[model samples]
Target: MDTIAVDPDLYAAQSAYAPDDWQSETTSIRSSIYRGLMDNGRRIPSDEQQFETYEAGHLVDLILDSDRDNPLFRSPIGADRERPLQVLDIGTGKGTWAIDVADMFPNATVRGVDLFPPPVTWMPPNCVIEVDDVLQDWTWRERFDLIHMRNMIGSFDNAEWDRVYEQCFEKMAPGGWIEQLEVGPFITSDDNSLPEDSALASWGPILQKCGDRAGRPCDIVLTMPQSIKNAGFVDVHEKVYKWPIGPWPRDQKFKEAGMVNSQHWMSGMEGWCMWLLTKYGDPEPWTKDEVHVFCAKLRNELKNPHYHAYHKA
Candidate 1:
């Protein structure tokens, strides 16, 4: 794989913390993998993770694009006629989704809020990024026409998640739409080819254990629709998309999506697992070396064509 070339301006736009400071913060939980630091102090992998994020956004666009009936969202706001639309994207990593949506609907105002500032220097005039944590109280004055939350499966605990939906309700205009896209942590194999002892098989349980111990469970995807409805959203609907972990599918579209999806998970395995396992792995906590070894094994399993594993979003 080629080294992902990140724009220098993106690095320059990062918060004032020096690279050394970020390194110091991760020392206790650091692995051999050199993870990059977000302004909010979370450790992400290298430029590969950024590229994966961008590519993942494209995959979602492709999925939504194919659904010509409800292209952007099932929300009625944008479907009928042209009017000013307000959109809020929660946990907007790198602001890719917000930028894309802003570009798609040039007349709409798109605001992305995240713990870290967005790296990109240029975006549509209608699009803006703000530094904010969604777990806290929301203080926005304007009500949004559409609220989008995606890929934030492991970010909140039970109570925090309740508050998130409530805030979405409070901040949304009447008849507004709230759409959340999250992938479940569990990996499944349709062909039952995955070995019971495989590293890929163990990944979800380990993450669930860690997340439970840390007070932020990873199973929110299962109950999010109900939560949204409880928060007063009417006409709630959900559509599941199965993403193959590797390029094992026969369908052309799924094959391409799986290839990108596989690469995304492969490159991000270390960054996602190391700290969680080190901090919360039960029975025995994992050392950096152990985490590294486990990740290597998991990556190999991901590449094995016989595994035929897929995750749902």
Candidate 2:
């Protein structure tokens, strides 16, 4: 990708807070030792990064109707109030899903594990957060009634998947359910309106190349259902949801979700591109300026309603 000079005023009007407040709030959250960083060596947990997490979570919930309704796919661990339940949310960014699940099932204890600490000032008594890497050895055996993993697409290597699934199987109770949610790296369009040369079209291959060089290919979504079954989880079910990147869908529900998803992608482009491209792209790593130029192009593509593109999960 070519490194074009980005106009400083491109995002000037989008700032919602003063620069000082943004810097201070971001600095306050920088004390966590486990926090990940971009190739530029900047910590990941900034005000903008946290907002992307919240926005993406909200968009997915809207698309899946995960809030205010039970999952259409039922778990073997039925709703028996007499039996105490234990829930595990792996790679829970910001602990949003865990907190919601805890609220939904008051009797169930929800535990969220991730490298970074959760940001909430208050959490339900039944909900707790643990800072740990999921790829490491899991000490808890047969301890959970349900295991939930979401948006963990680019976090693990190809060789690590089997072991991770095996660990999940070992940690779940006899009749527990394991649900894995992920968006495929590829972008598609029903009407073929998405230009082949568009920045959005180029995103997947670039990221995939980065992942391959980093030893963690991000194509696991294509094979996770089989992997789960191989791990000895019975009755594995996969439900694919298409999330429009722009507000071009006819259905009101999808249109709403598409709007939010568009915003989510817009806000997340910088953070996503910077680290992956800088650290793993072969031949030559992408500089911050090149990432900025690429992201500017991506933002423009995301807003083009004529593209009619959507990503599947």
Candidate 3:
């Protein structure tokens, strides 16, 4: 469902892969939720329906950080607003975050790069949402003041991840900052509202194993701290949040965040799981129908009000 725009001249001159020769075998007609790019090995959806899901995720992020002065990002880059800053957003799905940041820092140049261009019609003069694969050599002339990535958990393997972080370090200005946010795949309840024996409870380990089997590890949320440090970044700051799954939280902000996040999961889960489960399910590869049936059960569990399910971020 995702559409990528590759520059033909750039591809021909800089790489061996052609645009048309660039299809992934992971696409399944039976699973309407997903298509893959062999380049990033990513199956994040991009249709109108799925774009709504990504928009919901962007809203959830805003609601969670609403109390902060600048919820767009935590990097301390734009303290002197008049001073021109360069910012790069890797994996900029939907481009809402990049657009907001551009507005926030009108003098700054904000570049939102992704394998697929965001489904946005218009952007601010300071914002540029371009299609790019970051694994290749970065061609930008100016170094970035801030480099940010979010929801990029399963996009790369270990070596590729090191390369990405290294690129982040190399492309950044001398005192630049890098921030990444990822959510845990596990759904958990503190008061045992959801039983451990339930199929929904097994969601974490199931996909974790599937990701491992597929060679793109999905445990980036847990391992990112050390990995970032290993990439030569210092003065690392970490923040964690317990993101409630449904509108079950008593606090007003969390309840609102949960409501948005519920839709996020409802819309994005099928696409997220299709490639991993169908290609690397336990016992054997599962059929696309089986993946859809399992996602339906998960959705039902998410809709249960009594179950206070949440995943760590």
Candidate 4:
């Protein structure tokens, strides 16, 4: 639900694509939520609502806490109060990190950048947001003490990511930290809950194929760590978190978040898949009925909690 604002001319030109022509698809589809809201006689929340719903989860809080406690972030920035420390969150959807970090470090200024208009709003004096694609060429007159990119795999190609990291390196101050959080689409669990043919297993291959056909490989989850290190960041660290999809978790908080994420992701899966099928003329293999059933099955599988990590640089 990110509304991308491009130059008028560029936006007009791209708008010519039929509904079926856009190749890239969002991994989560909220149509089901919309339907659920409608069926329950409740209004569906806007992009802002969706963002807040996801951000309210404890998983994000845990991630932020871990990062704040990490040795790299604990390094002192000296007693220089005249110049505030700068941090950038790339592809920042809800600006959760910017808000949390600003609150955590009152002396630091944070900026969130994304291709779409940020769905959430806040007036924290220390936080700002810019609407633009980070993959595009940009000129920043200032350097940052920290650069963070999370969940950008589905949106940017591998080559584009390399370029983004290069830009981040150039914009980072000496002794700065760059953290990239990504997940391998290939899923795994110690509980042996996921079947071999599950979307968790098939997502990587399907997404890779779709990206290949589009001439932009969007699968960067597995390669982000090396990519960041290659961009010249020192004292890199990586941490992984397992996100449960549904209420099958033993932990109450995790179970709640998993149920929410599962509901969001499963409802959105069709739109994600359709964007590709409609583009590649491949809907024959996955009829609308099959797609719905698959999403339901995937949602049911979310009971097992599992995810990977690529937090580094």
lDDT of 2 by residue, 1-313 (tens): 1111222332442321222232342332221211221222332344647555553544444444633246422465636866888899888887767876787688889999989886666688999999998888986643888888877877787668888889888887867888877878787787687988888998888888887888777777888988888888877777677777655665545554565566667666687668888887657998888888998888777766567777777
Cα lDDT over the full model 2: 0.68
Candidate 3: segments with Cα more than 4 A from true spot: 1-47
TM-score of each: 0.80, 0.80, 0.84, 0.67
Clashing pairs in 3: none
Query: What TM-score does prediction 3 earn?
Result: 0.84
lDDT by residue for model 1 (89-151), tens: 998887767876787787789999999886675678999999998878888888999999877
Candidate 4 per-residue lDDT over residues 189-220, each given as its tens digit = 44454556775656556756776676555456
- Flag the better candidate by TM-score, 2 or 4: 2
Worst 10 residues of 3 by lDDT: 16-25
Candidate 4 has a TM-score of 0.67
RMSD to true structure for each model, in Å: 11.3, 9.5, 14.1, 13.1
Q: If the candidates were sorted by their lDDT against the true structure, best first, what order would they fall in?
A: 3, 1, 2, 4
lDDT of 4: 0.54
Greater TM-score among 2 and 3 belongs to: 3
Clashes per candidate (backbone, < 3 Å): 0, 0, 0, 3
Evaluate residue 65 in candidate 3 and report its C-alpha lDDT on the 0 to 100 scale. 84
Q: How well does candidate 1 score on lDDT at residue 178? A: 95
Alpha-carbon shift of residue 206 in model 1 (angstroms) = 1.7
